[model samples]
Target: MFGVLTERQAQQEERLLDEEEKIPPTSIYNLELLRECKSSRRRWKFFCVLVFILTFTSVAQLYLSLSEFKNQLLITTLNRVKSAELTKDIDIIPIHSHNDEWRRLPLYDALRVGAQSVEADVWYFDSDPDTIFVGHNKVFLSSKWNLDDMYLNPLFSLIGQNNIAKRFEDENVSTRRNGIFYNNLHQTLYLYLDIKSNSEKTMAALEDKLSPFINNEYLSYYNSETDEFVEGPVTVIITGNYPYDYIVSKSTRYFFIDAPLFKFKNDEELAKYNHSCIALASSASLYQLTESRRALAGVAGLSEAQVDTISSYIDIAHNNDIKVRIWETPSWPVRTRNEVWKQLITLGVDTLNVDDLYAATTFF
Candidate 1:
C-alpha cells in the first residue's frame, strides 16, 4: 500500500510538471519590436501617399498636354478656313474689263496671271470747244494721241479679235465672241467715262462712233447668230454721267452706281431707291456704308477704322445680298501678305483692289 501511494504521488507530480510545460508564461513586447511595427506602418502610409501624388501629377500633365494640342488644332483650323475664305471672296469680284489701267499689261496675260478684276477710265473727248477730254486727271492733250487710235481702237481690238475688221472670220467669231460675254475673257468692264462738255451730245456721238461694237447681239452673246443678245446682259459697268436708267430701260443689262450720291448720309433711302443697283463708297465714306447697312450694295477703300467695319458691312451685305470690296489697301506690300490677308478675311472684304493682281496673289 505504501509503495502504491508513492507511485501515485510521483505520477501526479509528473502530470503537474507536463501541464506547467504546456502553459506559456505572461510576456510583454520590447520597445524595439513595438518601434519596428510602428515604423513599418508609417512607411506603408508614406508609400501610399507617394503613389497618390505620382498618379495625380501624371494625370494632370496628360490633361494639360491634351488641352494644348486641342488649342493648337483649333488655331490651325481657324487660320486655314480664313485663308480659303479670302480666296473665294476674291474670285467673285468683277475684274475683267474694269482693269484698263493695266492695259500696258497683256490682257490675256494678265488674266493668266490672275487679274481677277479690272477698271477702265473712259473719257468723252470732243474736237469742238478746244478739244477737252473728260476723264480722271486731265493730263492728256489732243496732241498726244487720237481718241480712235490710242484708246478706242485698243478696246475694240480686244473686244473684236485678231481680225476684227474681217467680218467673216470664224476665228474672230468664235474666240472674239467668247471674249465679249463669257468667263474672264468677256469680263465685267467698268467704264469710268467722264462727261467733259455736253453729256447727252457726247454719248450720242460716242454711241454712233462705236456702232459696230454696240449692239444687243454683241452685248448679249458669244455666238451672235443663234444667240439673240439678251437685253440686260450688258456687262459694261458705266460710271459718271451715263444714263443708267435709260440704258437698263432700253437694254436688259444692269449697272452699278459709281456716284458718291448713292452713298448718301441717309443710306437707307438711297439703298431702297435702287435695290437692283450696287452702291460703291471709298474707305473714307465708311460711315455712310455702316448707316445704310444692307441698303448699301458694297464699299471700296476701307480705312484703318474700317477694318472692323468690314465685318459689319459683310454682315449687312450678306443679309441684304450685297457684295463688298476694298481699294488701295493691299496693292503695295507695305506690310506682310498674311497680315493684310487676315485682316481682309476677318472683315469680309470681298474684293482687294490691287494695281497688280499678280503681285497680290504672291501674298496668298
Candidate 2:
C-alpha cells in the first residue's frame, strides 16, 4: 500500500512538470515583446528618412526656379536700357511746322521745339513793295508782322547769340550746319514762303527781304552756270503762285521753287520741271492720295494700292534727291492723326507736316 502511494505522488509531480513545459516563462515573453518594439522603431526610422529626402528635393527645386526667374527679369531690364540708349543717339526726325506764322510765337516757337522746317504765307502789297506782310489772308495782315521783323531779325539774333557757325565747326569737320538748333549741326532749316499775291512783285520783295541772308552766305542758292548747289543755314523754297518760268530762267537764284506734285506724271515730267536744279521739294495734298483708300479707312490702316501709289511718288522724288511733303492731312481725332503720322514715317516720308509740333517731337 505504501509503494502504491509513492507511485501516485510521482505521477502528480510529472503532471506538474508537463504543465510547466507548456506555459512560457515571464523573461521569454518579455524578450518577444522587445523584438516587436525594435521592428516598429526601425520602420518608423525608415519612414522619417523617406520624408526628409522628399522634403529636401522639393526645397531644392523651388530654390532653382526662383533663381531662374530672377535671371530673366534682370535680362529684360538690361535690354530696355540698351534700346533707350540707341534711340537717343539717332538723329532727330525732320518736322515741318505748317503755317508757322499763325503760331503764338511764330518761327521762334517752332525752332525752340526742334522743327527743322517752318512755313510762312507772304502777301505782296504792291502799294508798298518795301513791306512784305506775313499772313494767311489779307484780313490778318499787320505792319508789325512783316517778314523781316517776324523771321529775319529773330533768326539773325539767335544765330549770333548761339555762335552756331563756331559750334558746327568744332563738331563736324566736313558737314555744314544749317538749322537754328545748336545741338544738331547737320540739318538744314527749310523756310517755305507761300506767295499769295502777284508772283513778279512778290519775288522782288522776297529777294529784297532775303538780301541780308543771301549776302552773308546764310541762304541756300543754286548757280545755274556752275551747276552747283551751295547749301547754307537756311533754304528758301517758294510755293503757292510762284513764277515757275521766271525762277527757271534765272542764271543764279538764291531761292528754290516747290514743284507741283500732281503735274509730274513721270520721270520725264519731273525732269522737265528742272526738279533737280530749281526745286527743293514737291508738295501734294495727302487727302487726294488717300481718297481712293477711304473705303478701307480706319480698319486696316492704309491699303496696299494706296501704299504703292504713295511709295511710287516718294521713290520718284527721292531718286532725284528731292524731298516729298504731303499737306492737308486729317488732323481731328488725334488717334487717326497719329496713325497717319506713323504710316507716313513707316513709308519713309522725308518731312512730316504737323500742326501739333510737341506731339510729333514726342511721338518718336
Candidate 3:
C-alpha cells in the first residue's frame, strides 16, 4: 500500500516494465552481471578441459615408456641365447607380422614370436635403385633403414648360421640351410614385400638384392616349365602395386604374386594360377569380401548369412590349395576381434594378418 503506483506513477511504471521486463537493468540480476556469470562459467569449463588433456597426455606418455621398456626386456632376454637355440624350441605359428619394420627390432621381433610371415613396405626410387628404403611412409624413412641392413642382412645371417646342411663342410654356407625355425625346418618363411613406389623399379631392385639368397639357394622358386614348386628357407611374395605381368612371364622366378581374393569367381577361376605363380590371395578388408552390414553384428560378430559369405570365398581359395588372408579387420572391443579370429581360423584361413605379434601367436 505504501509503494503502490499512483495514477501518475502508473504511466512511468508501465513504461519501465515494458523496457526492462525480460532483464531488469537496474536490479541485482542486470545484463552485465549475468554476462559476468556466464564468462566465469566459460573460464571454469576451459580450466577443467585443460586439466583433463594434461592428465591424459601424462598417462599416455607413461604407458608408452612402460611398453617400450617391456619390448626391450623381451628382446634382450631372447638375444642372450644363441641364435640357433633361440628359435629352436619356439613353434612356428601361422601369423603374419603386419608392418614388420614398425617393430622395435624389425625382422628380429617377428622371429622372436616364430611368426611364419613378415611384411616389409619397400619404397625404391629410380635414383636410389640399389638402396631400397623400408618404411610405412616416406617421411618416416631414414638412410639407415636400407632393406639389406634391416631385413636381408639379419635374415641372411640367421639362415647362414642355421644352415646345418653345410655345417660339417669346410666351406661356410656351401648348401641350402634349414628354415629360420629349427623346430619346423620344412616350413617356409613368407617374406611379403609391399611395394610403396614404382613397382617396376622396386621389384627390379629386389631381383638384384635377392641375388645372395638366390646364390645360396635359400629362396623358394616355382619352375613354370616343370610346374613345380621348390620350397626353400624363404619365400618372397610381392603385394601392393606389383607387376603381375612381369612376374608371371618369367619361366622361372623366385617370387610369386599375391592374387586378389575377390577376383576369383570359383575353383575353376582360381585353378588357372597354382602355387607356381600364386601361392596366396588376399582382400584389403573383410568389407570387400562382404559389405553386408550383417557381417558387423558388433560384439556378436558376423551374422550367419555373412559368415556363410566369408566361408564361401575362403572355400574357393582352399579348393585350389591357395592360402587366404584378410587385412583391416575390426580390432576394437577385443571380444569381437577374438570372435572374428576364431571364425577365420575355423574356416581355414592360411594366415592371420595381425598387428600384435604376441597376441596373435597366443590366440592361435
Candidate 4:
C-alpha cells in the first residue's frame, strides 16, 4: 500500500518532478557566476588604464611647468636640450641676484632661474693674498670658498660645456663662441664684485684669477685705445670701495665700474661718464638714491616724492645707456613688496636687485 499511489497523488508527484528538473544543475550555476566575474574584471582593467593615462598626462605638464620661469616669455627653441635640468628652456630675465654667495647654490642657482646679474662680496686678507675670499665680512668667510673655487672655475666649466659643439661645427653655424646658457647664446651674464677689502690687492687677485677667462676671450672688456666695449659671455662690474679711478685710468681692462647713481648730480653728469667709459650698471642704496632715512614705502608703497625721484634717476640711467638697479627696497608685507616692485618695473628699472629669487620671479 505504501508503494502504490492513488491516481490524484501520482499526478501531483509528476508536477513536483517537472519543477525540480527546470532548476539548473550545480555546474550550470557555477558557470553563470564565472561569466559575471569575467565582465567585472574587464571593467576594472579599463578604469585602471584610464586613470593611468590621466595621471601620466598631469605629471608631464607639471614637469615642463616647474622647470620654466614665468618671469619672461617662454623660449621653446631649446627643447632639444630639455633633457638636462640646467639646460631646460630658460628665458633670460633682468633679475639680479643680490648677495648671491649667501644662496645654497651660488652661480648655478641664479643661472637655473636665468638671473642676468649676480653679486659676490670679495674680501682679500693680506695674510693670504693668493685667494680672494667671498663673504660679506672676513669673520664668516670660508677659505675653501674663494673667488676661483666659488665662481670662476664653475663658470668656466659651463662656458666650456656651451662651446664644445662650436669647436667642431661649421663656421657658418656660429662665428662667435657661445655663453654659459644653451638657451641664450648671446646674453651677457654680469658678475658684480663688491670689494670688501683694499681695492688694489683685491683687483690684482681678481685679475690673476680671471686670466683663464681672459685668455679664452670669454670676458666682456673695454679697450681704452679703441674706446669700444667688446661684449662676451661674462661682464665683471665692480662696486663698494672699488677703485673707480683705477678702472677708468687703465688703458685696457676686463671689468667696468658700478656707476654710483648718487655721484651724478643730473643727466649732464651722467653724460660725461657715458661718453668716456662703459658703466654698464649703475647701483645705489634706496637711502642714498632717494635721500630716505628708512624704508618710507612701509606697506603703503613709495610716496609721490619718492616715486618722482626714482623715476628721474632711472630716466637718467637709461638715457646714459646704463642699467639702473636699486637695492635696500622694502622686503616685508607681501603686498607692499609687490607694489614697490611693480612701480619700479613700471618706471623702467633695468633689473630688480633681489635676495629672494623666487619672489622676484613672479613679477617678471
**Which candidate number would show the highest lDDT if scored against the true structure?**
4
Residues forming the 10-long window of minimal summed lDDT in candidate 2: 79-88
* Candidate 3 displacement at residue 173 in angstroms: 14
In the range 1-364, model 1's lDDT, one tens digit per residue, is: 9999999999999999998777655322455577899999999999999999999999999999998687546534433332223222233343332334334432333334444444444454554532224234457534333345434444454444423444765553543343322234444333334444455565556566545555523333222234233322133334456654454343333233443432433566446423443333222133454442221222333346545555655555545544455433333334443355556656665555455555556644
Query: Roughly what TM-score does model 2 have, to 2 decimal places?
Result: 0.69
Model 4 Cα lDDT, one tens digit per residue, 47-83? 9999999999999988877754441123222222232
Q: Looking at model 1, which ten-residue stretch has the lowest summed lDDT?
A: 292-301
Over 4 Å off, model 4: 1-84, 266-272, 293-297
In Å, residue 111's CA in model 2 sits off its true spot by 0.8
Clashing pairs in 2: none
Report residue 96 deviation for candidate 2 (angstroms): 0.4
Q: Who is ahead in TM-score, 2 or 4? A: 4
Candidate 3 regions exceeding 4 Å error are 1-81, 164-176, 266-272, 281-283, 292-295
Q: What tens-digit string does per-residue lDDT give for candidate 3 at 305-354?
A: 76888788887777767788887777877888878888888878888989
- Predict model 3's lDDT versus the native: 0.80
lDDT of 4 at 60: 93
Q: Which ten residues in a row have the lowest lDDT in candidate 3?
A: 275-284
lDDT of 4: 0.80
For model 4, what is the alpha-carbon lDDT of residue 341?
84
Clashes of each: 13, 0, 0, 1
